[model samples]
Target: MTGTILTEDAGDGVRIVTLNRPHRLNAIVPELLDDLNHALEAADRDPAIRAIVLTGAGRAFCSGDDLKDFGTQAADEPGTRAYIERIQDVTRNLVLGDTPIIGAIRGWAVGGGLEWVINCDFAIAAEGTRFFFPEIAWGVFVTGGVSELLPRLVGLQRARELIMLGERFDAAQAREWGLVYKVVPDATLRDEALNLARRIAALPVGPVRDLRRILARRDALAPAMAAETDATVRGFLDPATAARIGAFK
Candidate 1:
C-alpha cells in the first residue's frame, strides 16, 4: 500500500485499509481513487486476507470529490470520462469483489463519500457522523449505484428526498434509514470495526463468501453504473456546472 491508501495487517486474516489524505480530509482526487482501486483489488486477490476494514484517516471518512482538482479534469471530455471511470472502479471493487468490507465511518461522508459508505457490505458509523449527497444541487449525478441501492435500503420516497434535497443526516438517521449497520461512539469506532472484522475472519470462509456473492447479485447494478457514468461525465462538462464548481474553488 502506498500514496493516498495505507494498509495494515491486524492479524487474524484481517487487513485495515485507510484513506490517508488527512490534510484534505481524504478528499477524492484522481490519485486517491486510483490508489484505492489498486489497494482493493490487491486485497481481494490475496487469499490470506479474509476481511477488510475500510476507514479514513483524519476528521472525515471522505469529503467527496476535490472539486478543485476534479474541476480541472473537466476541461476536456476525455479527462472527465476517465476521472468518472476511476470513481466507478472503486465501486466495482467494493461491490463485486470477493472480500467483505466493513466501513468504519466518522465525520463527514458527503456525496461520493456517502456513496462509498452505501457500497460497503455493511457500514458502522460513529455517533456524530454527517452524511449527504450534494450532487443534484451541483448538477451532477450520484454514482456507485446509489440510485438503485439507496432506494432499496431506504425506500423509494426517502431515497428521492435524500438525493433531490441533498440534506445532511446524522448517524441516528442513517441507522433509522438502514444506511449503517450500527452507530458506535466516535472514540471506539475503529476498534469496533476491527473487532467485527476479526469475527468475520473467524467465520467459515465458504459461507461468508457465498453470502457476499448472494447479497451483491444485483442485476440492476451494471446498468445503473453505466447510466451514472454518462450523466456524471456530462454534468462535469456542463458550462453551468463548471461555473458552480469554479465559484467553490
Candidate 2:
C-alpha cells in the first residue's frame, strides 16, 4: 500500500507500515490518519500478515499531531468530527486487532507520537531516542488513548510525572519504566524491531491474539480508566490549547 501519509508492504507474513512524512516528523494529520486506518485494516484482513511493524522515516518516529493543521478550518469544519472519529477508530483497531504491532522508534516520540507507540503491542527504541507526552503543555489532553495506555506501561506515579510535567525520557529510562521492550543502538533500531516482529510472526496466531485480548481486558479496568479520566480533565486546561481552540472557532 502507498499513500501520502504512509507506505506498506507484506513479507514473511509480517506487514511493515512506514510513516512517510519525514519533513514533519510523521506528524498526525487528517490525511495521514485516513491512510493509516486504511493500511491497518488491510493488514488485519490479510491472513498472511500475522504481525505488523510501524515506524517512521527520517530521524523522528513521530513528533505528534501537526499543530498547524490541528485547529485549522479544514480540521474544524462541520464534517471534521468524522476525521476525529476515524482517528479513534484506527487506534481502537490497532489495539483490538489480532495482528501484533511493534513500534520501531528512533529520535523523538512526543504527545500523540508517544500515544502511537503506547498503542502498539510492543515497542523498541533507538539508544538515543526520547519519549514524552507534552499534551498538557500544549493545552490539550491526549486524544490517542495514552491516558488508558501509559499507566499500564509505566505505572501510575511515573505516568503522572511524564504526562503532567511533560518530561522527556531517554531510551534507557523508558526501558526501566517498562515502556519499551528493548533499547538498541540507533543503527540497529530497525533491525531489532524487525527481528522482534519475525519472532511474533512465528508464533501461533490463535494463541498470540488470545494473549493480546487477555492483556487488554486486564489493563482496561482500573488504572487505565482512572488515567483516561484524569487526562481528559487536564487536556482542556493545557497552556498551549487556546490557540488551537481559537483557530477552530
* TM-score for each of the candidates: 0.97, 0.86
Clash pairs of candidate 1? Answer: none
Once superposed on the true structure, which residue ranges of model 2 sit more than 4 Å away at CA?
73-80, 218-240, 244-249
Clashing residue pairs in candidate 2 (N, C-alpha, C atoms within 3 angstroms) = 139-238, 139-241, 140-235, 141-235
lDDT of 2 by residue, 1-249 (tens): 346455456467877888888998888777787788888888899898989999999989988877676544133334444554565666677887888999999998987788878888889999989888877666666656666677777788987899889988899998888888899998888788888888999999999999988877744544553454445444444435656556654
Model 1 lDDT on a 0 to 1 scale: 0.91
Worst 10 residues of 2 by lDDT: 71-80
Off by over 4 Å in 1: none
Residue 222 alpha-carbon offset, candidate 1, angstroms: 0.4
**Winning candidate number (TM-score):** 1
54-110 per-residue lDDT for model 1 (tens digits): 999999999998876855778799988988999999999999888889999999999
